[model samples]
Target: MATTVRRAVLTLPAAPLGPENPLPPLAAPGDVHRPAVPRARDGEELPPAMARRMTWAPLRSLLPVRRRDAYGRHRQRTDLDALVVENDRLRATVLPGLGGRVHSLFHKPSGRELLYSNPVFQPAGFALNGAWFSGGIEWNIGATGHTTLSVAPLHAARVPAPDGGEMLRLWEWERLRDLPFQVDLWLPDGSDFLYVGVRVRNPHHHTAPVYWWSNTAVPEAPGSRVLAPATGAFHFGYERALRRVPVPVWDGADRTYPLNGQRPADYFYDLPDGERRWIASLDAHGHGLAQTSTDLLTGRKLFLWGSGPSGRRWQEWLTEPGTGGYAEIQAGLAPTQLEHVPLHPGGEFAWLEAYGPLAADPARVHGEDWAAACAEAAGRLEAALPRATVDAAYAAWRPYADHEPKETLAAGSGWGALEVERGRLELPGTPFAEGTLGEEQRPWRELLRHGVLREEGPEPGPSLVSAPWRELLESAGPGPYTAYHLGVAQWHAGDRSQAVRSWEQALRYGCAWPALRCLGAADRLDGHPERAADRYAAAVAEARHARVAHPTATALAREAVEALLEAGRAEEADALLAGVHPTARSHGRFRLLRARVLLARGDAAAARAVFDEGFDVDDLREGERALEDVWFAVAERLVAGDGPVTEEVRDRARAEHPLPVRYDFRMGA
Candidate 1:
């Protein structure tokens, strides 16, 4: 019933960037050569401020774009390599051109993808800093959550295996955490499994927090549930609530399905004990895919959003959600998702996880037999683990000698959701829920990165960051990034004139249009539309050469277009739109701009036509249709207006998009 795949390493053209791939790079082009993470020598400690910030789960917060320290992937499609390696049973397409992510994994026997194959390698609103894409196994390193370089290109090669098969290998040096990470994936000539090996190094003198998870994607249907050897699970909610629940079945519903009506997204921190190493997802027919490991250290997790309107929107935004939206069957280094995995200076952590197919009667699924089947498959994969990674995992596990085999775990016993209190045990609430998110508690990186930078802005709040971060930004010389950050801090500290001067200094240091963009914003806020228009025009020209693959192009274009229109330069706005990449044009923000430009030109019919063509918000939680509805509401109301359209448009914009929301919580960006 499946196509017979050929075992060949065919180098293909670059994967085409789609509508979802429209993020402007946070940094300038040709930045792949930026300095690597400082090799942490033995005894070298991370700055206390940065060390304290490492434990934070990175949040997708909106912050001022500080791109000088950023690295951008700027090579056009022609400059990259796309390699496809396949055997009779499996096939994988690796895009060395794009962060070396395995673009697709197919099961030839069933002709189905065992991993979530994203239709578009697009950038969207994810990550605490920079951009993020969904699908495949994105390697997250550095200060946990989304690594800065996760979406950027890395060093990659295609090497022939001894058996005449091929392997695609990738490695990158993470600058923020001062570490290096490598991944090697292979599909054996005659095997049904895809083998993967990952190695991460601290290479520093002091202990540093490390968080790495291979986020494997799979199709999610009504009955699709992740099957792993666990009786209990920890869940992180969309609102950031932590819940400990019985696995498979929680409360009265099957926890595997997207049936948690109140919860929009479900993140299960699997309770993998020492022995169980395989996790699979069973569909309504009890057949899907599974990934396994021989080592006890590779923990499993199941993360999917609700099947509500909002969740459906995300599916369409990130990939083709309607055909069969995807979910994640993630594997991590430890039992808890929030645990700060530490790597000693010069320490390296290596492990392996294998992928294979699964088929069984639905009766066996939802029953104890499913667990047995998983264990059997896991046993079969023991031979597949690379000897080196297996040895390393064993060496790493031996020190934690007290862990019992997962087979002995029970729903009501062990570390089963016992919320750890101050040396006390209470299962009711998380430390975050208890209003006591101490400095000692893991900081959400979103807060850690800019919580302090945003402090002295427009509002008053007790300082969450009582540190010298400000001093460093101000006194760290006039490097472009430092100057930019210093500007932000000064602006937030209520010194607008000084912020302008610092931003000008950043421009002199080659920071380019981000400096201009900030300057334009300050000019506009100070009631100088002409000055703002001048800066926006310069930014528009600086962004001209940026194409679809350039990360900064779309964002810079958007800001410039809006500022041009606001400055009564509608024709100039229209002309400037020509330079924006077509991928960004597919977004609602760009569509809105086009419509506004038309309306300004008195071409009412054309504006309405453009609005009806399908406006879309790029955020995952809302699809194109939501923007269509907002457009209809605005357009219909304006047909009878004699004056300009109402301010309700911006309010409606807030409802339909994430960008309108303040960068900070409940306040300003």
Candidate 2:
């Protein structure tokens, strides 16, 4: 014989029978026409008159059916009696609202049919619901009104697996009190994967509300790539952009965006537009997962990935201001900031996004047609179109690199940081003015137009010369060349005190030719002949170290030789120029300096020979240009005068040269 299973039954107190009840009316037709009577309220019992007034009226008369009981005896009762008796038994044994209402019922003996129903709403705005199956378990759902603006629902179900194991489901919901929001979650069918979501709506005017962010965990194996479209490259905050890592500029290239390579503490605020519309895929060996977020309204895409265990705990939430207040949108690994959108009043935002598993062969991945298609798509979305706006904004934030200034001698307060011929010049930590001078090369061609630096000014003076230089220098940061130029400028301004101070500071920081000239000039002015010689020697040494053609260094050496000769140190000055061959010897100033040095040693023949070799008969008749004239006059006195070249001859030489010749090192050969 086969054994049959049965459910245990419990009995309870009977409910007060009345004609007004649907059960009694179904059982007796005469009970349909009933005289209603007022019920007792709070501590009051029903009066006999009221009870008698509630008696049923005979609206219709019908005979009851006769049926055979288990004992084979005749029972005077109809099918309606059987229904009423079963209903009474149900009412007596099970409470009406204990297991909630029957939302939907299915008689799925074969377990192939699926049925669902909308949740029920009760009169007091509370609903109790359940689903049951024959020979199976029952699921119940209930709700309770907590306050005027809050309500909570509870759900209970028994989930059966194909393996005969059963799981119990228990979940709760709490509607926000006095807020236009509700949160709910469920362990549907008692599965480990929980379905969670939140709905937020505002009935009044639109306003920005603060939403709390939740920790989202992602799990995966190693070798997963997270792809996203960034405005530029990811900043680790340790170094400047583009220079920090090996990322190419906004031009389309195959360089890594440096997203996954960043440290955990690093955060990206405004990503480049190209990188924003990215899709990141995390793959482990061959098995991998891909997630893409698409804005339903704008159709913008954001791609993300995860790996190594944390991927499983990943969740997405939309929240309001309160503890434990949020709506869980996604329950698996998902990219953050996927669909950041503002919700407007009476506006609905929906996203059409997906997550799926993929298998890729590592050897063939890069060459695969599918991989090519993905890359092409990514390039089209992020790499093809130029993000001019984003690039412009980023460019605005980047530090500028201006050209080195040209002449620092003519320091003017109105001079700008940039100029056409000269690049830029300003005191350290001071702002670049309207007009300045700078180097010959176009340094900022990559940033602006190549000819922008060459534009002429409206008028003459500092404004005409300094404007371009100021523009270029204002864009640049502190550099060695800039400091050197500034020191020279200080020296030329006749502020020898300040000039020496600035040059010393520059040397302490870094030694350059301009700084050396300032040092030498300051030493000569301060009567420190030894220090001036040392500065000139240092300049030559640095020039050799740099191994480049530096006119400034050569000029400083020449000046040092003259100063030594003035101090009656002819042998020392000659020794300084031992290996240094004079280039551009045809220049009038070069011959003049050589002539002066030769005359100082009383070698009148050699001095006259230098003038003869360098100057033409007409050039000599031209009365010498400034410095050359002074030296030529001294030579005339040495050769034509009978005795030593006296103070009167020196005064004539000084008048010819005009004291300072304004040596320009920037002049071309």
Q: Which candidate number has the best lDDT?
A: 1
Tens digit of per-residue lDDT, candidate 1, span 437-474: 33323222223344422222111111111123355455
533 Cα displacement, candidate 2 (Å): 3.5
User: What clash count does candidate 2 reach?
Assistant: 41
Residue 46 of model 1, lDDT score: 36
Instruction: Please estimate how well model 1 matches the true structure, expressed as its whole-model Cα lDDT.
Output: 0.54
Name the runs in model 2 displaced over 4 angstroms: 1-479, 489-496, 524-530, 550-554, 614-669
TM-score top scorer: 1
True-vs-predicted CA distance for residue 579, candidate 2, Å:
3.5
TM-score of each: 0.58, 0.26
